[model samples]
Target: MSKRRFIAALIGVLVAPLLTVVMPAGTASAHGWITSPASRQEQCRAGTVSCGEIKYEPQSVEGPKGLRNCHGNVGRFAELNNDGKGWRVQNVSRTTTFRWNLTARHRTSTWEYYIGGARVASFNDGGAIPGSTVTHNVNLGRTGRQKLLAIWNIADTANAFYVCVDLNIS
Candidate 1:
């Protein structure tokens, strides 16, 4: 099967069984929460999650019980046109096993993953970089909120790539 089809099939397989767990059917779907724009550069004036901005400028929201609201603000270096290659965020999820699905184009540049404002994983070091849809799992236990900033920096200068995340609260 083609890569695209394979990704679709994989997503179907992964989400199909998840649908069986009834959540008392209600207006609010109990699935993972996703912000709009689906990209950092896109203008998303809605949602409790705001990206592409420095300093903890977040939109408030009612998160699930035990699931703290994650507000990620890229550091000044992470801002567009910044020369430095470092990115940072303030308090996100103080303590939790946060899993996020990052849909990005498969490339050679290093793709880092963070949760609650700390570095958790990277996709260049044998990490899977799905050109279509891919999920990165990070388990942050007993860690402070300052440990959840995931950065995907390119070793070489290149056009900014779109990175969208879907957070699943357990």
Candidate 2:
């Protein structure tokens, strides 16, 4: 056999096995949530707050992009929108470093933080795949028991992950 034909056959032999392997369809592989300073979902997952379905899947609070609410406007995780849930406030300096623990990595567009309908900080990723963990030093302008909304905008999709972190800044 010719060298070209032999290489073609070898490639087919190696690739056929991989193609035969089955994978579940419609599986979501990219999800993330804030852990440090404990977003509401993290607080729920850690038993620091009494929450609903979000406790089991803290990284799944995904919804349409450009939304300002927590829980991503999802009905099941809607508990994140409640202010009376006795959420714990983390004390941090004016410039706080928010840490994200990503369950799966994806191309990121931007990370935005909002408080009382005002945007405080935004980090643009230029549509690059993020690492399993991501952190940003955000200057939260206001102080004294503020609920900050953090949004991770996906690069290709119209979806974004949302988390709310309550903070008491000094």
List lDDT for all candidates, in order: 0.35, 0.91
Candidate 2, lDDT over the whole model = 0.91
Q: How many residue pairs clash in model 1? A: 11
- Positional deviation of 130 in candidate 2, in angstroms? 0.8
Off-target runs (Cα >4 Å) in candidate 1 are 1-45, 49-106, 114-118, 125-129, 155-170
**Model 1, 42-86: lDDT tens per residue?**
212232234344212222111222221232222331342221222
Candidate 2 per-residue lDDT, tens place, 1-170, comes to 99999999999999988877864455455599999888999999999988888888899999999888998889999889999989999999999999999998878999999999999999999999988999999989877889999999999999999999999998
RMSD of 1: 17.1
Misplaced by over 4 Å in model 2 are: 1-30
Scanning candidate 1 in windows of ten residues, the lowest lDDT window is: 28-37
